[model samples]
Target chain A: MAFDYDKYLRPGKLPHIWCPGCGHGIAMKGLIRAIDACGLEKNNTAIVSGIGCASRLPGYVDFNTLHTAHGRAAAFATGVKMAKPEMNVIVVGGDGDGTAIGGNHFIHACRRNIDMTYVIFNNSIYGMTGGQFSPCTPTGAKASTTVYGNPDPTFDISKLAIGAGATFVARTTAFHATQIDKLIAEGIKHKGMAVIEVLDDCPTTYGRRNKFRSVVDMMKRLKDIAVPVAAASKMTAEQLEGKVLTGVLYKEEKPEYTQQYAKVIAKAQGA
Target chain B: MSSPRVEVIERYCKGCSICVEFCPTKVLEMDAFLVKVAKPEACIACMQCELRCPDFAIKVFKD
Candidate 1:
């Protein structure tokens, strides 16, 4: 059968609410392609999102969607999955919503190795909240909240997820549309918790203040800074210092949380 | 091969014109405070306009 993406999109919501030159739209298309590639049944899919520009994704998608509170996408997604184990649950949110206020939940979710895919749209700023400093905001970067420059170090989200026990973790940029779609598709197929961090641009909030001439300039920067993981591994720390690594950073097989919980429940029932 | 085509939903457009300003190929134009696809042939199907519009008013499709 032929694949049609427009079927999944809400007709009236054609124009998304992200600022022009923002990277979220590219990420969204990547996600749609991934979902289509995986052949996931739209009726069985459930998307949960937190408050942010990225969180608005659930509303636009045709599947079962929930727009939860800020920084609680994972928590709400966990509940959705646990309640209906058959549902293919995916959590979507921005860097601040996923790595800042939702940081703790993110770690525990990874550690639990739940059967869910977490897609983080990391634009390095709190776009929805007026360009505040996000946990992933790079050091010395300027934001509306950080007039001088962001003094805090950025969180390497993929690395953090791998370290926290996610079964699969990948990193890609909005510029690498095909790669992003492939990685997201792989994440969805993984048995245990999977995390994909998509490096995106926030032109209005993050770009204007940081001196990005335009959206194209920001995309070019992403293309230049991104280094394939295979190539990066062969380089020295100094060589890789300022470069961003893209591709699957880690993957492993582990018993999923829901499956383990089912065993425990069976034991109790027998007892 | 030809490039991608961009469609702007004028009703949803808040006249941000970011699409016109940010398109790398200069595929979009601002006419009367509204964005119009001036150079659809230059689009790369990047979906940058769709992603960047705060109003969610744009879509990129192949020709």
Candidate 2:
């Protein structure tokens, strides 16, 4: 039997604004499946995002959604989690929105160890904002702003989340369809802050500037460069060079912020 | 009827060709920027096209 995705999708929202070959839709499906797998009720879950191509996702899903300003999804999602600790809060945004503009908020959210899931659609460029080079854009890659090739260094988002004390961090690409949901489901099931960075493609803006002939070419490139975490350990450094690691990269247990805050409130009340 | 049902929701399809290109059994084909069931008998119902579709325009149902 086919998966009944329509159950979670908001009616009359089909035909999303993403381009024909864009991978954001793929990520959206994975998210829907993850939410279903976790058995989350639509009313009890909140999907939050900031401005970007990926941020538009919350509008299409049937959930308590917050489409906040650019670089503020994490901050808003943190607030949502703090106020409604029982609600399953999930944050979705693009690489630029999550890392570049929202870097401060992003790191702080991870540091707090809030019980929420943050899914970063790392397309490596600001697709909605005219192909501008982003912090996750690989050096030497071409973007609208980087006509001569991106000279700026890239921010490995998974590593940043892990460093900021997120309990769970995972990375996967759009080409690996099945793994996306599995990792997301795991992240949602995990106790503290979980960050799942999905390396999707922006064929219209990033691919055209970078000389990718077609969407298939871009997907094939993503397929070629990804190496699973278990396989990466056995491969030589030379063989692993230029390859992105997928699967759960980091995970740890810690005190969650909302729970700690509740304790503080209780102590203040002398209860 | 013998193999499986491959449904293409034309209203939602953007005709990206990702499904036709990824179909392992070559059971699908493009017709004027929309997907059509070209060879229904060849469909193994693997759901690759359905899973990879960026648009929710395709589905494969097997009983």
Off by over 4 Å in 2: none
Residues A1-271, model 2: lDDT tens digits: 4688998999999899999889999999999999999999999999999999999999899999999999999999999998999999999999999999999999999999999999999999999989999998999999999899999888999999999999999999999999999999999999899999999999989999988998888888989999999999999999998999999999889999999999999999999
User: Residue by residue across B12-55, what tens digits does model 2's lDDT show?
Assistant: 99888888889988998989988888998898989999999999
**Cα deviation of A59 in candidate 1 (Å)?**
0.9
lDDT of each: 0.86, 0.93
TM-score of each: 0.86, 0.98
* Native contacts retained, all candidates in order: 0.13, 0.62
Poorest 10 consecutive residues of model 1 chain A by lDDT? A1-10
DockQ of each: 0.21, 0.76
State residue A109's C-alpha deviation in candidate 2, in Å: 0.3
